[model samples]
Target: MDTPSSSARVCGERPFYDLHAEAYDLIINDPVKPWCDAVDAQLARSSSILDAGCGTGRHAAEMIARGHVVDLADAAPRLLAQAAARCPSARTQLIDICLLPTADHDAVMCRGVLNDMVSDGERAAAIASLARSLRAGGKLFLDVREAEASRERADGEPRTRSGFTSRTTWDNGLLRVRETYAMGGDVVEYQFTMRPWSVGSLTGLLRDNGLRNVSVGGGVGRRTPDRLFVVAF
Candidate 1:
């Protein structure tokens, strides 16, 4: 039987992260080696990196260990706190990607964040903000869900990990997800929406934001099936 406290309610991305912060690392612990390898291959030695939308600072911590200067930024305070705790040496900012500083880093790695921008205007603004965060000739690395593949897999059975159970459904162009965490006598639930990206549409957005030399490839690590790893300069 389900917990009596279980309730369904819509939530935005920030609130979802804030609620999920404590369980995030355990639930979403995919290996970071592949992504770090990609970054190493593309960036200069000892490059300064901005881990935009960084959740728990896993990537930033790894990048710092590999001799790169990494700063973390995210809109969710709870998530950012966890990130800072994980990477105490790295600088952190509590700000959205759309308001990131201009020309500040040698490269920016934004993983699993773009899909949350459900509107074209929000997507455009985000890309533009990321572009502005780059120094001249700097690169941008993005990991996002591929629309077709994600939609095809959206209706899969519920997945439980780290005391959380998650189910997803694709409707129209949105991927709606519900996550429930039940531990001891307490239960928490969150629902959120995401809009995946197609190659052509994403490419056009990058170009419009003055980000050229776009390359889209298969996902890194465990995300290979339904995600796209994109690189732009």
Candidate 2:
């Protein structure tokens, strides 16, 4: 849902969140506890965690509530501000997933972000960067919108929030969503392109990046199986 323009890369996706940061929580009401449970269950030890693209810092706050040391990172400074307010104790960093800092983390989580990479190269680079952020034997938990599910959603109803209306359409393997927002007298249109990766393909990507024990399952605490949560060590 956060994919950027071809010319601008992931950095281009920041404006959407920055503009909609105040209404982000209202639009996206997914509970964070289940994801926290899933991450906790897979952790061999809970010494430290890196929450990549930690929008609003809910995940980091949940992890911190569980007594795990947390580092919250995101490309959007506006979102990072919100995250900092939510989890005051977390170490906040302005980071890009494709160029994560070298650190040995017990677990690294990147939920609902991989699909944001519109190209294969960006996805590979992001996965490799996350792998580098992990220590040996550390687990990585990531989730992406399944390709089939994206195709199915193309036929669903459109959603609207904070003067913005969004509708999805699928062409070939790309999932495209067009959002139109009413900003006072001006109307702005934001179009995002995401490549939905299947579980098999995602598993291959993780293993190719030197990550092992990759497994894919339904998204944590979500009734719809559209999101595939992948765990690798």
Candidate 3:
């Protein structure tokens, strides 16, 4: 998958989420466990859950073990391979976020994504779709690095590394990728930009998108305000 160029303010249709599925999975391992653990408690266990952008099926594997009927969606065939391996019984599909509608899931989880990419109109439409997909009181969780925070973290050089996400014949959750970091600082900037979003702005998005009972909370484990929670019908 690809993402928009760094020079633009709005993101184009770059599906970078699946580009380095293994690296993405490693990133998830760092920040996702705690946040998702919280999510496991926030949403009912054993319910139908959707893991949008389930690169390498890391989240899906956990959900399956937790007894969720998980539907994993992504646009990368390679990543889907990883997902299929991780949760052989999971319902998997190669799909784009903009093409899917909501309401079939009790909860949807798309982390370390969404905020970093997605055009404004696209974000609005996606949020609406997510809300539409939820049953009354269903929840959605997403994560993003704040633009303001990105400035603080920017090293002014886009970190690049050489690695690949490959699919093996064995349908098991085996993956490997060399992780790279994008340099950012207080003066850094990005095209698909984001800002440090308070719980209020996030809740506003949720409420504006037809979601209610919104909650803005910080995450544990990582020193980043990575998780944002929302609920809707």
Candidate 4:
């Protein structure tokens, strides 16, 4: 389900919300830590922010801790629940970004969601949907995998996860997705889904959606290009 291409309501790749929301953070570390830190440093104060693909509410919690009014929205119901648990005051929504409602936030944030959808068309649509949620001059933040970077992690500690397990096996071009779970109102069965996306392609898509001042920032690990940003209308 690449962006600007596939339909979440139709593709059936498992709604993220229904996935292991309760255990996402336990499985994944701060995938885009640098970006979060940047967001903390450079964002409108007391603004309304939307954590678009807020997985397990990690970033949302960070934003709330910083005093930003946050709306934790995601396609996964279970994930939203977890986010709510982390920040009970945050307004949570179970929304598939590709099919989001009308609203313009002061700022928006999304990470690790669009890349899962493997089609460019679907990815584009999803971003466009996110753009619509932003008001004029509302900044948007998102991160996708850098197509050119290799996923070769140095030999070190053993990595593990819940619900699904993934490993970087391609010389530097594939993300290995494996595992399945049927709970939280959905079923997730996936493995060996490779994604090839580049920074240039992402910038083009953002411009197509009328976003200005798009930029790419540091990713989760200091070693990787984890995210791209779109300062929206």
* Predicted model with the maximum TM-score: 1
Q: Name the regions of candidate 1 deviating beyond 4 angstroms.
A: 1-16
lDDT of 4 by residue, 182-213 (tens): 45566566554546557777778878888867
lDDT of 3 by residue, 1-233 (tens): 15322212121222234333445454444544665576687767698888876777766787788788888877667777888888888888776665566456888877644553334565555566556666777777766444344444443433343332221111111111122333222122222233334455556767897676665444444654434444334
Instruction: Give a tens-digit lDDT track for model 1, residues 85-121.
Output: 9999899998767767786689999998788877777
lDDT of 3: 0.56
Q: TM-score for all predictions? A: 0.91, 0.89, 0.69, 0.76
The C-alpha stretches of model 2 lying farther than 4 A from their native spots are 1-16, 44-46, 183-187
lDDT per residue (tens digit) for residues 46-130 in model 2 = 5699999888888889888888999998877788899999998889888778778788999899877788777777877788888
Estimate the TM-score for candidate 4.
0.76
In angstroms, give how far residue 93 of model 1 lies from its true place.
Answer: 0.7
True lDDT of residue 35, candidate 3: 56
Candidate scoring better on TM-score of 1 and 3: 1
Candidate with top lDDT is 1
Selected candidate, larger lDDT, 2 vs 3: 2
Sort by lDDT, best first: what order?
1, 2, 4, 3
Question: What is the lDDT for 101 in model 1?
Answer: 76
| Model 2, residue 121: C-alpha shift (Å) | 1.0
* Worst-scoring 10-residue span by lDDT in model 3: 167-176
